[model samples]
Target chain A: MPMWEESSLVRVVPSARPRKLAKVPFVELADGRLQGVVSSGSDISRVYVSSVAAGDFAFACRTNNNRPCGGLRGGFCNHVTALVGEAVLQYGGARVARYLQAETAEAADAAGTAAVPTAQQLTAAMSAVRPQQSADGQAVTGQVFSRFLRHLAYLELPATTAPLPEMHWFPTAGAVA
Target chain B: MRADLLAAELPDLDEALAAVDAFDEVLAGGLLRPQPAQAAGLNALADAVAGSPIAALVAEAAEKAAAGVAGEEHLVALAAGRTALFGAVHDAVLARVDEATGRPREAAPPFEPGAPLPVNLLASARAWLCDVARAGWRGMDHELAATAAPVVSALLPSAELRRLAVLLDGFAAELAASCPGRTLEQIPLRRWADLWARGMLLTQPGAIAAAGAAAESAAGAASTALTGRLLPLGVDLHEHATGVQAQVHAVFEPADGGPARLVRASVSAPKPDTVVGAGAWQLLRPHLSLLAAAGEGRAMELTGMPVTDEGDLLWSDDRAHVGESADVFTTARVALPAVRSGATAPLDRHPTRIAEPVLVEGYTVDGSGAEVAFVIGGERLAVDTGRVPAASPLTPQAVAGSRACVGLLRWDAGRFRLQPLAVQSAAKSKAAVAQAGAWAGGTSDKNAAKAEKAATDAVTVLRERAGRLLRS
Candidate 1:
């Protein structure tokens, strides 16, 4: 039990949800990238694994089998956009912006009130950066999908208020958000 | 050598927290079950810190737990001590950490602090009258006279604020005829005296440091903008002899990260009879949408908002724009601060706690209604329902069933109590989070159906009253 500092409330400008999370699940900020599995619109059985690197905004989107998404034309595909939106939901806009180092100078209004980038702006900013697809798309896809499957395992536990031994590291104090 | 010994002998902060966490595991399961290991850990910690400030109290509690006294009273006392000890230790650890990090502590203000008073004196007079009446007019007259007489006498000569002082005296005199007793602490006498002092202080410019500075700087500071997730908790309606006031209780999450601020918007009306508990929301509906986003929190973009030093947001309707409504349970569970357990002695003496109070979450209610204690972070904090508004849906039954709650945490009646303003039964439930009562003014979808009839009845009565007043 390390003595935590006198905790201060963290202020957040909650990101606007421009897209529903059903399109993208298993979104995470990990391994220096925003990566997740996204559902294919036309084919329910098909799924796309997408990722966008933090800096330089380099991105890659491919089917779990490493087939390049038809929508990827040197810029973000729909799957990448959905990944960013879901990431905003999981980790707030301020955090996502900080992670990606996204430009916020243009976010200010005429009166100069500070505003957080909308999902559309953040996605568009990612698009402006010259698209650099990762070479190991299949390996990244396998990693994220396995993580998603691992999360689903949590639902199996019988519900109880008692603290689980495995989840003890989770901060018991005020929420960081 | 003694200094070295004392430093080495000090109780370890991490061990204390770990011990409390372990104790919470046992207490949450019900105190009747024995856990020898947990008791031994506490007893060892107590033994380890013999001369520390809390050693005796901790040792006493550990003794009771080790004895396996299965009595309800023993359990209750253990629960109280557990909550108090956690807070005290947590604060002490933070203070030590701050010292180690060389963080500058807040400098104490030079002047003796006075009770914070609202700007409006007329409302204060009416509220004081209400409190006196509610307390069966007991021994309040002498206390009222003793507090008010000097303030009124001081202000009588000032022609500008004389009427306000006179109004305060009238309320005091009205109660002096009956209700005689020697008990000074029966009602919130300090609250009554706060308004009196406020009136007297207003007559002299710059008498009170914070209030005076706020008044002088308000013009230049009005244009500051704040953008954040605004969670409207519930509405608190104050009914006095002269009128009714509905204060929309809300918290503002800043765009960056630091501390959340308590933002409040108030609407007052002269018609006290027509505007009651749940009905007051109707009057405020036109000015603020905070009520609409009560249980389910909202993201807000605002410009030109004013804030007090105490972190109270001054509501300016025209300057604010409401954005998306967030998941109520997630917002309540993650965004709100955790309740810190400790002796509320510092808070008890003050007329008003100057620190901005953001609502607390992650608490499960134990006990029923006003008698309830919030079991949170492994400690049980009791609820003092005396100040909770009648329109709030946080009833006795509501307390028991709620899985999560969002409410203002206050120090009252010798302990910290969570006055739940909003409650969520389950995550992603259709209603999301339901407001504790009818105070939302049909804003919360959960209570919208219930508040509809009450608001409608209030409106019809208002229309009839207007017709008669105009005709006469």
Candidate 2:
């Protein structure tokens, strides 16, 4: 996704007004996890979220504490929420729906059906289930559904988020270079 | 309006304030005989603890930490007193802010930029000399009396030449009150340097900078004298450059100090390139924290990959938005001989390499693609050791716990380009060990005697083993 759009998600999610910044280059890992480098003052930190493409959706940033967004402590913070939102924007609802489905679609998928609910299908199903339940029950259902969706929201689409095979960058010897 | 602006900066204040304990703990822990290199970071931390007041306590705390207390009770009382003093200052900052905004407190006079400035070199020098003498009189450093004597010399007074000198006899006499040697004249450079440093505490920061520049002018006198590129500092060049291998003995917690309102992320290597990052202190904090945690006191090698200075890459992004400039922190205070030669850790363990490193979480660092940290002195550290010159011996297989001098054009703890130099070889060292083993394989009378001794001691060993077995 374009970096400006991603930044706008920063404002949009716990999200505030968007500020133009250097483009945050987010690459899609082969396993469907979306990864990116966010500027950390002369330094850059690695932020990534797992694809429900396989199973559980996970979110992490090297700069973050055990709690998301540097342990603000209340809940998933603006940074994580924004990154996840950017992933959803980049990968499309359908792709995220696939990863989220991978996490909870054990029984039927194990039976060789392999069909997992797409992001749109899940969103529709989540909305569809609300009317049948009480208000509090719907709130709980919405919270759980939103939590799952948030992780998938940041997953890069398989179409654009290709990451190179495993490799790391290190310094070589000689004079400074 | 000022309070409102300061209110907007509360987060930065919070960080500097919060860092009080972490920074104070490190300083207090090493209160005894703290190295000169430890001073800068501690000063930065102290600023956050209580602004200038905590700073006033630093020299005294350093003295107390150095002077052996009679008991732990005394030490605890000394520390508690310092803590209480710091708390008072912290409270004072908040209290003043509230008071200023709430009542009719007179506004602080604004700084007049174009006013006559203190550029009277002679007056400042005399003032500094008198201060040094007074400090000696107060028993701060009696050796300073020797340094003060030369400034008062007839020839020196007539010539008005500011130069390095050695007044060896006066110092010993001043402290001992009965020494054989009288005050001597100007001697050789090295001896002059040694005695000159002995009286360094007597010299003011402005004088030190002047001396540094003067030393630069006398570069032709000494063969090993710092010149064009050999010195740690760059001449007319922007990016800082050099090769130094030293342990990161301590990483001071990020703190704000000085008139510039800049927070400094200063590191001191054995051959340290302490490029103090100032002005944007608040924005520069998180980066300092990482440098504090990851590279502090750890064997790290960095190269100043200056774009012009035969370096490979720039650690800072050329296209990145400029936040702060190196020029802002330039002052006489920055000219202190930051690291004493004695402060550096022995450097025979690490391999030499340089690069503009970022320390990404999952990139392969070593040749073996091992995710393991570089373990040394029982601390696990992650340093980028991946790519190198074909002739370089800094591969992961080669780099271990060796001390590395880091060369850099600049350092803010946020972004710095460092190259490791003077690396001690792991392969050659292991090969030497293997060679020793091979020599052991040869028949030597000492080895034979040792074997015989082992055999003779087998009975005692057996009894100990049997007893252990019985207990089990």
Candidate 3:
């Protein structure tokens, strides 16, 4: 039930399929190191992040142990936080950016010549600057949207950009830097 | 003299012949008369013989006349003739004595005791035949009367035989009435015979064999009925508790050399590894010995096997008497800490006095991912811990940890031992980590020390944490 909160952002892969996504990056904040691996898919994939509540994060971390030590104050350990960061960078954040840019480009071509860009088109145009690689050797364009920064990096975008929906961010002053 | 005498005899002879004819008719009718009549006739004939030489000839002529008569008739004729002769003599005498006699004086004969009487042996024989015939007819009548008496008495409807028939009819009527809507008349005679034989056997030693057979059949029917009733109830109760299809197997046996019976049932259902509690033996402490003894030659048999109220097995052993007093409660408690939520409140509250021997050992997964082997209750069980293949749908953690776990703390061989699943896992993990570190460092000796240190550290951490929790 706790996973329902992130339902809109995450998709559950079919249990039968193995290794649908590749290259998850794990960032260790304690040692300032980044580690990434291309994992073969499994029946259960839980990404633990320190940004989540300590109790919730510990539960995710100890999924392997099967016994969830309930109500731990600061979460299980750093092992889980690194795993979550890697999963987001590899699978979720890059995929969303490419989809937005493609949709905006298609909408622009369909309109008459010298078509003025909408707010969504402007956001998509800025997201086109970041690039990533798909598993099939295809280029994946990243999104530069203000919301993308808030979600993937847990950072607040400057208000100088076009008007965007207000969103509350978890306290992560040290995680992003 | 000649004419008068001759005429007198002639009249006697005529009278005798007529009497003979009448006696013949009575003899032919098969009747017997009294004995006096024929004796007097023989006396007259004798007197006539003495009177004249021609008297013999006259008597002969009289006999010839009576010859046509039967034996009884001849005797009658002779008797009449004797009487007539006497009368004639008296007449003759009176005529001779005319002066003395008034109104024909009668000459009286003197009585003589030794006089010979003519008996006509042939007539007597014929008379005896008629008597014999009459006696036979009388005897037949008596016999018929005797035979009729019992038969008629029986027909009168109050004899024992008749009464029994009536009672049986009444009994049959009552039986029919009791079972209304059934066709009583159609009942087979053999069935009645069988029932009668059964009833007789119960009361009489003569019927013992039949009675025994009936008893055995009845017992079989009762056992089948009991099984049918208990089976469904067991299944329903098992499903209610475990939320799975419960399979039940049962065996019922008549007690061997005992009056009591033995009924055994086993139930199996899928159980979540997380759900744990004391085993069935712990709950049913009072009857453990009996259960163990009863289950001795049977498989999947356990002493004090846990059962629901409906006789569904919650836990069972693969072999009987193997874990007769294995302390299931401690085993379940240690194996599943998730169910307990890691609370050890009960241990301090009810301290168990350890007075027996025990041994302690830890096991873990080898490099090949096969579980470490350990022994409990004299049976070896392995916990499977393996990494999930990358291609597998199951995650690495679920593969490594998903196991049917059990733990035991025992006093054996003069020592106390604790065998817990957590300890097993920790040992396996440490070994694997050491082996990996050794390979990475390219020095087995260095890695061995490192592994020992790591194990020491882990044990120290666990002890400290457990102590703190127990103190709190």
Candidate 4:
């Protein structure tokens, strides 16, 4: 028997509440960008595919038809905000913060007391200091939407205990290897 | 289709079993090639059951299955196809195919002349288990032997059932050996009893249906919103012949003045070598942040959590958020007094289950700490150290006059014993009040440096053992 190390035991700290992200259905950290698909609020038929580069905060939000979002003027739009929030919800706030290179220092609240910054707060802190940047997210938008559509397809599957050929990679408990 | 009509259409048991084996072999091969689409065995099976209602669906399913893996989102497509296929076969074909006793079912006689008709074997197994839990295995050795007699006698004797009987007999002998003052073997007696119980349950007439129902309930059942303070007790790792299982034990005190429940999150790896190199804690890094919060004894909120029948929390799609940190000292002081004395009773909900979680507080360590017993209200409960091979024995110096301890109460060596997971101690000075996290030396991060060194030492021991083996 060996004693466990202190680093392995992580002590958690309180952070801010996550922003609502129901508009965004898919979010992922991949290809050096935080990218996802966000459905349009007003137009039920439309969706916004968005991306933000890891280090530079370079962002893009365009519809599936290559139409650019009007909310990308000086900073991140609501779609991008929803994307980051959902990304935080899916991955931990710490992991998402690290991926986006967002600073995680404790920010002072209105009462002048120290408060632990969440992923959203960290991202906001980074955006406040850096100059606005943009990127062409046209190529990755199609890939993200395609993946989202595939995710939706899982719902169509009928309920059964039979082993799926593709699910062989995911082991179930009590399964005989 | 009607049962009589379907039975007429069905192939003999041998043919059906052969077909199923062939299909299973193909599945086991996974994505590998060399086998052709639409295997001959599958076609033959379809032809043999052509008169059945689902023969066409079976053929279609077989063809789609034989086709090689698909593009992105292959899992969804494959699942839909497999579900439809299995549903058709199960409802129409396999339902009538009696693989166990075969068609024209054997008229096996009852073990006793006046044995209960349509015997509830599962209920019998459950009652027997409840008795064994109340009394130690040795106390119930006679009942354990007698319980197996009828199930074996009533069932049509097959090689499989005979082997099960032999297994039950072996367990009885082992339990009898665990008499007072006897050196007990390391074998997990409770687990063996659990296995025997499940085997006995399956020997009944409606066993398959009962099993299916149990599985369905386990998969779908979720508890309502659970708000509580969770204290991370410790982590335990065990290496089995097939793989490794690591568990995180904790005590969850519900906010609404409900009884405390022991929460356990376990991760298993069928292939150990792939995950074991980095150490068990590293393997569980994904849950590290949450566990670390609980390690400090944090107030948390959980929703739609799926708990095992035995009450250990299962980590599947459940999400928990850490809130304000709780003072572990005050919490333990308040919580310890609420727990009732004696071994934690077995849950009647799950009959064939083992693993009863318990927390024992305010126990003074007896003299000669090398082999220790917790003296609680004049009752001596020995600490079972065999389960935690890596943990150091509880020394008087470690406790430092604090009596708070939490662990699982289990039957071991002909009696019940406490396997301590976490312990607490008080500070010598009043200026610095002993924080729960600091006193959690039993499982706290303060032991990290020592843990790393121990891991290195373990590797060296393994190398030396290997060298000795080679020399031999």
Strongest candidate by DockQ: 2
**lDDT tens digits, residue span B1-472, model 2:** 1222222332343454334333333332233344454454344444444444435455444344345221232223333333433344333343333332232222222322222213343333344333332222223232443343333232122111222111222222222221111221211211111222223322222322232232233333432121111011110001111111111111111112211111111211110011111101111222222122221112122222111111111112221122222210121124212211111011100011111111111122232335334332333334433222222223444444333322121111111222332233334445211100011111234743443343334323323322332223
For B98-204, candidate 1 gives per-residue lDDT tens digits of 33223233322244443343444434443343333223223343455334444444433333343344445433433332223333223222223222233332323
Off by over 4 Å in 2: A1-177, B1-227, B230-395, B401-424, B429-472
Candidate 3 docks at the CAPRI level of incorrect
Superposed Cα deviation of residue B172, candidate 3 (Å): 60
Per-residue alpha-carbon lDDT of candidate 4 for residues A24-98, written as tens digits (9 for 90 to 100)? 655656555678778788875577888887667788888867688888887888888888777776555655665
* lDDT comparison, 1 vs 3, better candidate: 1
Whose lDDT is greatest here?
1
Candidate 1: segments with Cα more than 4 A from true spot:
A1-177, B1-229, B233-237, B241-243, B248-262, B337-364, B368-370, B376-378, B385-388, B426-432, B437-439, B443-472
Worst 10-residue stretch by lDDT in candidate 3 chain B?
A: B231-240
Q: For model 4 chain B, where is the 10-residue window of minimal lDDT?
A: B344-353
State the fnat of model 2. Answer: 0.05
Error of 3 at A155 (Å): 44
Sum up the clashes in candidate 2: 37
Ranking by TM-score: 1, 4, 2, 3
TM-score of each: 0.42, 0.19, 0.14, 0.34
Native-referenced Cα lDDT, model 3: 0.24
DockQ of each: 0.01, 0.02, 0.00, 0.01
Which lDDT value does model 3 have at B319?
Answer: 15
Task: State how far residue B205 of model 1 sits from its true place (Å).
Answer: 5.1
Cα-lDDT of candidate 1: 0.46
Assess chain B of each prediction and give its TM-score.
0.53, 0.18, 0.14, 0.42
